[model samples]
Target: MAILEVGGLTKHFDIRPGLLGRLLSGKRRQTIKAVDGVSFTLEEGTILGLAGESGCGKSTTCMMIAKLHEPTAGTIRFKGRDIAGLDRAGLRDYRLAVQLIFQDPYESLNPRFTVFDLVAEGPRALGIWSREETARRVLEALSLVGLKPEEYKDRFPHQMSGGERQRVGIACALILEPELVIADEPLSMLDVSIRAGILDLLRDLSARLNFSCIYVSHDLSILSNISERLLVMYLGMAMEIGPTDRVVRNPQHPYARALVEAVPVPDPRYKRPIPAIRGEIARPIDPPPGCRFAARCPQAMDACRRDPAPAMREVGPGHFAACHLLDMDAPDSGTAARAL
Candidate 1:
């Protein structure tokens, strides 16, 4: 069953240049296309890994899904209703169903409150249960993340290790029994030795708890291990999306190929392909017409400069890529399975 669906979702931010910079700059106001026309779906009891560079709109997409940021265009339908249309009261109900596990553990947790108070905050804010109920639920949530309620409940954020702090963050999200979790780099800040354990904990929690997940990470290695599917984002657009094995093994888009090639391999014998990307991303403030990846894509044809949408070619069983190269109709009819 589909738990979350987002279509044509876009977010643009108004950027103002610095005082001295504006004097030298051509435009006073600029638009940052943080997320532009992204679409994807997540089925229940599965994980969708969203991977891209720092400014490629990965975090922006996560925020839109979590309802923390309102989209500039398009619809985000959860369960069935358009959550973007919800009012304050309806949004409260929406928050309980969909939760966000922020990236920074220290910034997300409350230093003033003990673990018990921090974890219980969500249930308490929603007024979902009585004080007794809050305590009971908080205890259960703490245990779910591997912390003993009695041992860790009274400790402050500063007292525990990095992994423990993150567990507290997870406990907070799980307290609401949310159906979906948008974990934005849940382990990005953890110590290297403990990162794998944290990933295992997330996989363990998702299985036993039976909730859908949007696991956002820049690291393809982690996504390959934890996600059921992967979506590659570039300049706020989805370059490719498919089953994890398919996307990682035979990436269709040039941008996706570069990312895969960049992944470090332990074996010296496995020859890595030459990376195909060049130059930094151009400003999204009125970006050039044509494929977002055109400037960076090595296989750029004259038509790519015209800006084409992903034509949905079946690269694998359900794998798809959005590139003009895959979409050109052959002279003879009927090899349609490979249409972009």
Candidate 2:
């Protein structure tokens, strides 16, 4: 069974009126559909990469999963229990079981806290562990993330490098022995040289500890390297989802194809024109009906602009894509032809 199942997960931020504006228009309000109708299942002990451009709702989805943002619609099932309806004690358990690693370690970590305090915060809050047990767990977690407690425990956040701080963040997240970890661009702020080490640490720890992860990022190359499966999002909606290797090599949706083509090739000598995705990303506030990516999709049809949101369709074994072009009996375009 899947460890985490997110079905029709949606988060909409209300754009409320200011005092004068509210007085002018009594109860009127608009909404920013940050995440819309996203659904996926995450298996135990596996990493699912959520990849898209900025404002595509990757981070928003992660926040919703971590319960930092409440969902306007949909259900989040962790271990077959709906998290949305969790009571006080259940919510506390949920918080301890599902940890979030923020994008910037420098900003996320408290300047006042030492490494040991930072790592011990969760366990101490739960009040389930004695002082000795908390210390042992903190030490174990630090070691798991390649940070020695003796060397780093007493150091303040300011004393550590970006990489070390990120490791500290990882250690803190793992100290609770969470069943699922939601990492929101955890490697984006680090130096290029340090990213690989963090990625390796995450992958190795997941393997050894048997925990699932939702790795959110805009970097397709990094996701391809670290995630077993990839969930591609465009303007708050899932464009495609499948095995990372398959999605990278055989992207079915135009947006997914564009994302794959955008990955930077390291070789300076290899010169090829990268496929350009034309047009600006659609605004999230009160977005238009129909497919959110339709306006920018090269393969979009007349039906795509008029139809209600397209449903996910199986394009290959374990590979699914949301595109009007994938509908049965739909005419094959040059883009869809190439995708097949």
Candidate 3:
């Protein structure tokens, strides 16, 4: 079943001129297209990895899904119901079902609170469970994340290790028994040795609890390990999306290919060629109508810059890429391009 569906999701931050600039430009306002026309679906109990470099709007997309940022356009549907149309009570229900895990564990947790208090905060705030039940669940959540309740429940954020603090953060999210968990670069700050354990724990917990997850990261290597499906983004648009193995091994979009090639090979004897991505990232402020990656795409053609951004076209079964090259695969290529 599709647990969450996001279609044509967009967020544009308007840059209104200050007094001096307004006097010069006369009410001119520029818009930053943080996210534009991003679409994807998340299946129940599956992990979908959202990957891109910094400022590609992957984090912004997650934030919009979590309702932290108001989308300028598009629809966010959860369990087949449009979230934008949800009533206050309905929105509250949605919040309980969807939980967000922040990237920085130490900053996310309250330094004054103990592990038990931190884990119990959500349930207490919402009054979801009785006092006894909340306490029991808090302990269980902590234990599930590998923090023994007897040993660590009373420890403050300052007392725990980085890995342990992250475990607490996970516990805080899991305590809600959420249907979907959005983890935004959760392992980015952790040590190499400790990251594997956290990933293993997440996989184990997902299997045991049967919850869907959207794991966002800039590193394709990390996503390759944890996600079942990979969605690659560039300049606030989806460049490619498919099964993890398929996307990692056979990326269709030029941007996605660059990202796959950039992942380091660990073998001592193995040597990988440097990725050929050229040119700097394009500015998001009032960007041109053409493909956002056209400036950097090595395979740039005249049509690529002349035409508007290409819509996602199916290049293979269950694999999609947004590129002018994929138009040949479409039966109604002209119509598809016109639709965009």
Candidate 4:
């Protein structure tokens, strides 16, 4: 079942130049479309990996889903209710159902607070139980994430390693027992040896805990391993979304292909024919109309220059993508849905 659904979700960030900041001060200003027309669903106990470049609106989209940043426009429906319009009290309730694990463990954790304090904070905020009960739950939470109370309870953020701090962050969020967990690049900051362990821990925890997850990362390879489905975002727009393995193995969208190609081959015994994606990624502020990736896309066509493509289409069963070159028919509903 779809535990969380986001539709027509768009967020705009006001990027004011110094002189322009003064001129547009106290006035409606030009905006950066951080997350424009992104729509997707997270099924119960499943992982939906959102892969994109840094500043490609992945984090912005994650923030909106976490309700940390409100959408400038669009609907966020969770458990079939439009919680997007919920009030403060309603939002307070929303927190018990949806929790976010941030990317930077060092920054997300408070250096002054002990591990026990950090883990117990959410249950405290939500009035889950008495001090004694919350303390018990906190220790249990730490154990679930592989950190024992005796080992980590009194330790502060600075005393812990990067991986251990991140585990502590995960413990804090999981203690809430939220129905949906938005893990925003949780393993990106850790060392290579520990990255897989953390990913495995998150996957195991979600299955046992049964909280659907939205894992946001710039690494497509990580998404492929952990997710059942994946959404590819470029310049604040979804380029493709489909079953995880199909999209990663045989990508239809140029941007999706670029991402897969950009993944480094591990074995020295194997020589990869794929080349590194050339040119710099473009900014999201006032992105071009047609295809946002056309500037760097090797297969750019006249149609791509003329107008933007449509929503993801099924090239195979449950394997959909948004690209004009893959289409044989002219513009029609068959090609793409109207832009959200």
How far residue 125's Cα lies from its native spot in candidate 2, in Å, is: 1.3
Question: What's each prediction's TM-score?
Answer: 0.93, 0.92, 0.93, 0.92
**lDDT ranking of the models:** 3, 2, 1, 4
- How high a TM-score does candidate 2 get? 0.92
lDDT of 1: 0.87
The residue ranges of model 2 lying beyond 4 angstroms of the native Cα positions read 17-28, 328-340
Clashing pairs in 3: none
* lDDT scores in order: 0.87, 0.88, 0.89, 0.85
TM-score of model 3 vs. true structure: 0.93
In model 1, state the lDDT of residue 86.
Answer: 89
Query: Regarding lDDT, does 2 or 3 come out ahead?
Result: 3
Give me the candidate number with maximum lDDT: 3
Stronger candidate by TM-score (2 vs 3): 3
Query: By summed lDDT, which 10 consecutive residues of candidate 2 come out lowest?
Result: 331-340
CA lDDT of 153 in candidate 1? 95
**Candidate 4 C-alpha lDDT tens digits along 245-333:** 98898887888988998887788798776653568876676666777777888877777766655556667666667778767443545
Tens-digit per-residue lDDT, 1-340, candidate 3: 9999999999999998688867875668978899999999999899999999888998899999888999999999999999999899998888899999889999999999989999999999999999999999999998899989999999999998899999999999999999999999999998888999998999889889999999999999989999999999999999998889988988889899999998989896988887979766764877777888888988887777875788887666677888888775565653323222
